[model samples]
Target chain A: MGVVFETVVISFGILYRYNLFKREKERLAFELEINKTQTTLQLIATQEAERKRIAEDLHDALGGNLASIKMNIQNMAPGNTQLSTVVGLLDKASEDVRSISHNLMPPEFSETNLKDLLANYYNQLNNRGSVRFNFHTSGIDRRFNKIDELMIYRIVSELTNNILKHSHATEATIQLIYYEEYLEIMAEDNGVGIAPQISDGIGLKNIQSRVNYLGGKINIHSNSFGTTIIAMVNYKK
Target chain B: MGEKIQLVIADDHKLFIEGLQSILDNHPEVEIADIAENGKELLEIVRKKKPDVVLLDINMPVINGLEALKYLKREFGQIKVIMLSTYNEEHVVEKAKAQGANGYLLKNVNKADLIQTINLVHLGQSCFPYRLPAKQGLPGISDGFLEQSNITKREGEILQLIKTGLTNQQMSEQLHLSIYTVETHRKNIMQKLKLRNPAELMKFIISNNL
Candidate 1:
């Protein structure tokens, strides 16, 4: 009887230890997943910073050099046939460089308030392709914190990029409605609808994360006609 | 075009200044008197050259365009200043106008609009990008605009009267107020609407459908 009791106690101890180990392992796995997501987020932010730095370098260095070259070539005077052609080429190349750098880097946020940034982005989109862009703003003059502004800008830019890449549609509209307490953005594209079985891609996921970071909500409505994304955030938050 | 509009262009970007210089050099009615890299330099050149107009960029080293504009207005009120910029942020434009900038133009504007703006500024009329009707002056004194802009009820009444082509004297008579009070009201309306002069206020009244 004594031997049997001792064996039962040993068995209980083994079972208890196994369960504790299992629980700890599960907790560690969950933490690893969270850490992975956090790293991804940080990596993305760093990548954007890197892109901006590179873009600025390219613009300030290469673009400045190109402009100077063109100026020098033009300064050689109009009668020089060969130089004029080279000057013309340099001018075209400089313009291309400007466009590329602009695409790579964000606008000077300090210089432009939110409304101007949106209008400028819309104008750029309109210029880039056949898409007709209609940007409307109401009571959007008030400024927000820099982080909020940057996040909102990123959301808009990412959404627009998706539209330009995937939506073959010709017409799109972006609206910014500023309420007393909250700011809302609505972007609509008459593109091919999102597939029903399609999972959220990286772009959409990035937008979702940004909106979440801003303590906002985003709703995407898509059909055969097109897609519309509505996002709202409380400025106070 | 009687006397070509003499211009002093101020921009930090050397390439842009040169491009503008080349463009203006070809124009019959526009002459580039001098170019400055920044606002301080602009002031120095303006003091020497006394150009009829100064095309100023908003962002510059060693005193911004707006800062220089204030000084210029205080010292040399006769020289018309046009704010030329790549970005048309409405508030900045409004502030520039409030500082007595005669006009605003985008750098990307075609030669025709640029020339037209220069001429208009020279003629003592305010100018802005044609696409930006509201920035040139208040487009109209619409009820929505009044509410959005926080114009008082009395001010709204005055604005409406002004829109109807009522002179300050006529408004004083109609509203049963002193002419001095009416004049004060008119001045307040211009300040609130960011209109530089009576002509722009009139344009605003017509364009706004008010």
Candidate 2:
């Protein structure tokens, strides 16, 4: 009886130790994951800041100089063919700068709502006419935080870009359903679905990271017909 | 009636402002009151001088043109404000109009048009080159929507091309029409439908199954 009791106590000690070790391992893993996410979020913020700075420099500095040049050239010679040609080239360069800057950083989010922003972007895509894009939104009359809106915008852009590049899709639709606490983004396209191998590509990965950053989960449903992506992000005002 | 139009120009770009100043100096009917480098200074100058016209740049430091326009219109409603912007965006133009701007002119406005617009605004006339904002509310796409809207068959074809994301140049190449002709058709379609921009046009097309 004494030997049996001692053995039982020893066994309990071993089990407790094993449980403690397992908990420690899980804690370390959680810490590592958190550290990794922090680093990634910092990187994303830095990238956005850099992009914004570059866009501003291109728009204000280069754009202003180009406009001044055009104005000067026009003032110097109202209709001189040589000067007119130079002016035409200047206009083209200005347009290039504008587009590049706009792509780098869209117009101020404080100035326009997300729906208009998305609509404008889709309109631009439709101008390419490769795919017919439709955007529908409900319960988005109110605005979200700037960062949240920008992230959502990027997600949609990335998804559409993927479609434009690979999906061979003729029709695509992006729908935003806003609830009280969370926003659901559903992007669907009618084309050859994303292959399993291609699903691991950088585009989708970028989207995944963005969704993760937004504290959201993304589910991708792909088959021979097309692909549909749904991401739900919980947001705070 | 013989008074020279007193003008205060506000812009952040020194070179562009100088170029504009020289152009305006050539006009005998216009007189320079002062120049402000930003919207804040613009308001200050306008307060002191009470200029007849304020040529405000949309993008400026310290305070933006739109905000200053609001202040100017409220404090000194008599001072005519002409938005001198590099952007010809329809929304921006619409915002300016809604904010009580007397006129809207592109930064690259020619000497003749610039002078004409300023004079016209000073004389209590509103000048805007772009089409006015259409009525709010999307028209439902019924079966006879196109017919009711008077969209022509050629216009319909162009609309289809536009839906396919074809640029005017590409459509011209494919359809054997000049870019100008394609643009005309597009404009006519938008006017008939009373759609403001391509996005609305696309939305209408998709909703109507056109």
- lDDT tens readout by residue for model 1, B1-210: 437788898888887677677666657888898899989899899999999999998768899888999999999999999997644445556678889999997555544677888998899898964442322122344468765554544566787888878888898667655565556556656755778898998898789766
Tens digit per residue, CA lDDT, model 2, A111-220: 77788777666766666568977666655445467766778888988898899989999987676766557787777677898877898999999999889888899877
Q: Write down the worst ten-residue block by lDDT for model 1 chain B.
A: B132-141
Predicted structure with the largest DockQ when compared to the true one: 2
Best by TM-score: 2
**Pairs of residues at least 3 apart in sequence or in different chains that clash in candidate 2:** A128-B165, A129-B164, A129-B165
Question: What C-alpha RMSD separates each model from the true structure?
Answer: 15.1, 11.0
Give the residue spans of candidate 1 off by over 4 A.
A1-108, A123-129, A134-143, A177-184, A195-199, A232-237, B1-7, B13-35, B83-100, B103-128, B132-210
Where in model 2 is the C-alpha error above 4 Å?
Answer: A1-18, A123-132, A141-143, A163-172, A179-182, A188-200, A217-230, A234-237, B87-91, B108-113, B128-210
Report the C-alpha lDDT of model 2 over B87-149, residue by residue, as the tens digit. 655567778999999999877666678889989999999999755333222234334667566
How many residue pairs clash in each candidate at the backbone level? 1, 3
